[model samples]
Target chain A: MARRRGERVTRWLVGGPPGAFLLLFFLLPSLIMIVASFRYPGEFGGLAPLFPAGPGEEGGLTTENYRVFFSDWIYFQIFLKSFGVAAFTTLVCLLMAYPIALLIARSPHQRRDLMVLLVVLPFASNFLVRVYAWMIILGPFDLLFTRSAVILGLVYVHLPFMVLPLYTNLEKHDPVLLDAAQDLGATGWSRFWRVTFPLSLPGIFSGSALVFIPVLGVFAIPEILGGIHDWLVGNMIKEAFLGVRDWPFGSMLSLMLTVCVLAVAGAAAWLAARGLQRA
Target chain B: MRRAALAIEALAIGLLFWSFFSDARYALAGAALAALGAAAALGAFGQRRELPHFWLWFASILVYAFLYLPLAIVVIFSFNDSKLAAEWVGFTTSWYAKLLADVDMLAAARNSVLIALTASAVATVLGTMAGIAMHRYKPRLLPFMVLTPVAMPEILLGVSLLIFFLNTARPALALFGIEFDLGVLTVIIAHITFCIGFVAIIVRARLAGMDESIFEAARDLGATPWETFRRVTLPLIMPGVIAGALMAFTLSIDDFVITFFTSGVGTKTLPLEIYTMIKVAVTPEVNAVSTLLMLLTLGMIVVAGRVAPDVLRGK
Candidate 1:
């Protein structure tokens, strides 16, 4: 009985602080954000009081935020554009990372560690610096505030995330499979297409996830490198909260973004699981 | 075969580097280099039979060039003796000098270091406990709570925390007759919240690699759980904890978006400071600070990598 009590005390002692902290700091905030999405904007800024007003007064509770979101085609358009940019970023990252990750994975052991480090080295720099680096490169060409600039910036910032996961997945494949394909009179293109490419679908899925989800919420890239028309949902969210000071509207946008991201993550997990089942 | 690969690989890297400098100075030369590089790359791609995976190496070398050339420009132009970053007329250290003289930048750097130090220290303790708890006891909600912060979009956290801080602090503090708002302390707490996930992941990975018997042996020796952890487990996972701490330090100092939201008006981190400067104007002074920040981050992460190789591997 004494020892069991000691064990129970140890579990609580070990788990209680972080659990309490995350619940308060992370989980509570998320719940508040959800609640904020439903509350009306204050007369000045932020949300109005949490309680419903004396019947005739302004509504403290509202579906107006969500109504505003769905009633406007602009919000849907921004969401669509954000997804388009994310898909473009993910696709480009894969094209760039695939060969580099493949090569790093296939390299001899002693050299592999060094190559992996090299791949991640550029990514270690400050995020703004990486984005700012392109401003210098593109400024002379009149490309600084173009849509191309935003897409390029997004791709460059996220390239390492794609490489690391793809490399991790690619490194685990059996060499004999490739060798057998080669011995069976398969051409290099056919071998990769038929065998290697299919095998790396899992890597592609994970790398795409790492690249895609963050691009949806990215504000700084489009803010710096993009023109006025390059506004994604992120910029609108930033404008809503910071510039326009519409905290309720910002919460609604964030709630939508969170839902979209969770859906993408869920679908990716489901597809990945189904792919594994088929395999 | 190897010689052919090396020759073409060097040529590709050279052509890529050639455009980085000459583009602004001589657009013709830059175009020529680009055309020649593209032809050689295509030729290598079309003739993969002779070279034997030579295109792979060539493709990877070009990718590395793409990865690095922009960063190289940032570092190089920091010392460029020009007001604009277009052409490198000469080398000078004036930008670094200007950066050092700037009071706001220095204050921001001080705040960043202070926040990183405090947050990483606190996060390391909490994260280590979280790691150990999850590993040993396999608690239910703890893992979800710990890992979700790392996986979710950074802006979501930033936005939610902004709302939470704004809503909770004023009213909660008013009950005690104390006023609070978003600032340095809020930034620190936000940093700690996000950082705990990363540190926990690293520590858990470290714990995962060890044999279970060591802890069991300590427990079986008539020692209490805490006593066993002190003598056996702590010494064993010390490197991991240190690595986690270093990583958390770098991450906290490097973070921008979350800090941007939670920092409100007064608190200025290095990244936030850089954001304001970059927005106002493009200056070589920004480059100088960026180069120094890069060196600091690289230095700490390198040391951390040396201490625990798996830290680099993300294992």
Candidate 2:
């Protein structure tokens, strides 16, 4: 009984502060945002009050914001474009990162550590500054305000995300299997195809997810690199809240984005689970 | 095969070296180097039985160039005589001097450092306590709840926090007869919110690997629970705590989106200032500031790497 009481006290002391803070700050705000999404935008910009006086109230509660988003062809196109950019970035990053990861994985232990350190070092730098560097590199040409520029920036910023995970996965892989396959008359290409690539699928999935999700929601990269001509969902959300003051629309979009993100997350989890089960 | 591999290596390295001095028009030479290096590495690896893959070494070198190019450009331009980032007339440190003279830039940087320091300190305490409790108590579903912030998009978190401050926090504070507003305080709170997860995960990883027998040995020595914790547990996990604190500090300093949304009027952070600066024009002064920020960040990560290499390894 004493031990039980002690454990209870410990739990409260340990979990109470963080739990309460997140509940108040993180979870509660999200619930309020979701609720606000169902409401209408306030007149003259900004979010409307929750539980407004009546239907006549400016930006009162309504589902119209979501309806407008779903109905608008422009919004759909923007969403599609955002998805395309993210997918393209992930694909490019995967292709580029694989060789780096393989090279690092094959290095001596000390060199491997140094290589991984170098990869992570760039990521530790200011994200805005890195994108700014791209702006300088690509800006002189006519490439600054284009979708290609946006894709290039996305790939540049996110390549490390893909490489790190792939490297980790590759580093843990048993090299003896490759040798075994080689002894069994498997050629180099066939060895990778038959043995190495299959084992690295989990890393590929994780890297893709990591790259795709951030690229999907990235605002500054697109805004700064792609300029005003190319806007992703991140920019759309930013404009809705800060620029347009259409909180209702922003909320609706946020809700949709949350759903899309959750769907991607759920699918990844499902795939990982299936992979685990098979193993 | 050996001769071909060596030739590819030499060509790739030669192009990479030549690209630096050939001016901005030949910047594509860097890209060419990258491509040739990749192909050479592939070719060498495809025939590994005959000769070693020496060209793979050049491929790794080019990959480093790709990763470091932006930072290198920023640092290089900071010393350029011309105000334009692309042009390189002669080397000058005037931009660094200009950055030092800019009061607004200094003020923004001061604000960033202050907020990051306070946030990291608070997060370390909260996260360390939570880490200890979680290991000792093993609360159900709490770990998952804590990790939610790390998984969510920054924009979503920023937006939600903005709304929360406006709609929930302010109104609630008003009920208590206090005025509440968004500024440094709000940004700090948001930093702590996100930072707690990182600290907790890192500390927890350290705790998981700790030998439980040490704690028992303390207990057997008739040490009080607090004394055991102080002498044994605290010392054991000090590296993790420091690592987590460094990460939180670095993240908070580099953060822009969350800070942008949370910062009210007159609360500009460094990233916000840099963004505004770039949006107007890409001055050499901005390059100097960016280069400094990059150096500070890399320095911190290097220190953190030394303290807890495994923390960086994502173990």
Candidate 3:
């Protein structure tokens, strides 16, 4: 009994440092951000008292920052624009990825390997490089400054993320299932809709989530490829904190983005659960 | 039926060839011929039990072109010699030589190497610990803790860290009679913060796959917990730790968005340097630098693949 107790104690001692480290660094920074968001910025961007004073006070607990974001049409427009870009990017990636993924899944082994390498090679390069490559192709022809360019860049950057998962899921699907569907007198469309599409949903969901979440917070693509009108919420937050030095407002925006991302993720999880239940 | 399809496909191929080599009119003729041939082939093949294999082959080529053409252009242009930057100049190694001699590029390269090595090492240790603790202890806040760093957007994390330093740390350091400029140290800290999550996730995955009986067996053999961990568990998880470390290194070296937000005026990493150059225009010099970076990353990924192909093999 004593030996086992001593072993448990040793395990705790061995494991204690990591847990404490994460708590201090990861958890603590986020906690500080949340607290700072609620408080006002002090002299020269320092943290002021938690609650400053009443309306018109130099430093006070005010919901004005939050209210400004919510009440203003511009902030909402930026939010919508970011959402729209993410959605469009996701859709384009799905369109481009599905056919390629299908082809990869169906190809002979050597060819499939080559295709997979091609897909992963671009992905392994710096994300900025790939985006810059697009800028080169699109610029001087009035293409870089367009909204479509931003979407194209996003889709290009994320295509592998979408394709890899989809290809894996599709590759695992039994050929016999499709054969059986065809033998049952189903047409090509029916076979795809009934057999292939349903089996690929998990990959589709995961890929979309992976692409959508990051693209939502994409900072550089729009900044580089987009004109003045194409700035995302990410750019807005960056500008607020870095350019304008508005910490409270930036914090508020960050909090809003976090809430929105969680809400979308929750919705996705709920939808996925419903789908599994139906299945 | 097969003969007709083959004949039409050949005609289409001939037309495409002529279009590329001949005048605009011939090109148009070629495209029309190819389109008609393809349509007829699809129509005929659609009636058969098996869908046309030609469609698959054609689609595959198109997909490959889409994925590779841009990269091909960049790689090709990197060898160009003209200052025009757009038109294909004669191929030369001068740009590469220039890249070698560029002081700023070399400094950025050195900084990238330093940051990647230091950040990967620090993140590996911390991440391995976190992974083990999460696996062994099952802490109540583990999920939230892991998700906090992973889920928060890069911009948010960057700005938050910036705020944390400026608001909290800067003044406190001044009171200690030390003036700290946000330099290499700040960049390294940021890289470590982000890299930790990546390492933790990879290592955690490896830990999940590990059998619990090994540790139990070690205990049964009268080994102390530390001895068991040192002797048995460490060897088993070393691959995972190394894999995580490689990932952290790649992420740190490739990172631009976070580094941009946190790095000071003087601490220019390679990605940041390339980004600024790109903001002006796509120079052949930038392309040369990019090609080198791409080669390095590809080499690292190949090594990583050999080390842990299973991690990347599945979804």
> What is the iRMS for every candidate structure?
0.9, 1.7, 2.6
Residue A257 C-alpha lDDT in model 2: 85
DockQ for all candidate structures vs. native: 0.80, 0.63, 0.51
User: In model 2, what lDDT does residue A187 have?
Assistant: 86
* lDDT for each residue of candidate 2 in A176-234, tens digit (9 for 90 to 100): 99999989999877988888888888888888888887777889888887767578899
Worst 10 residues of 3 chain B by lDDT: B14-23
Winner of 1 and 2 under TM-score: 1
lDDT of 1 by residue, B245-294 (tens): 99899889999999999998988989998898888887899899999999
Q: How do the predictions measure up, each by TM-score?
A: 0.96, 0.93, 0.88
In candidate 3 the C-alpha lDDT for residue B300 amounts to 88
Candidate that scores best on TM-score: 1
Q: Tens digits of per-residue lDDT for model 3 on A199-235?
A: 8887787778778888888888898888875789899
Clashing residue pairs found in predicted model 1: none
Cα lDDT, all candidates: 0.87, 0.82, 0.77
B1-315 per-residue lDDT for model 3 (tens digits):
544554555556445433432347445665757675665665465545444454544544455556666676677778878765555647898989999999999999999999999989988997787777777777677656655666656777787777666666677799999887677888888888777777777777888988899889998988877788799988888888888899899989998877887787789999999888877755789889988998999898789778876555542
Model 1's DockQ?
0.80
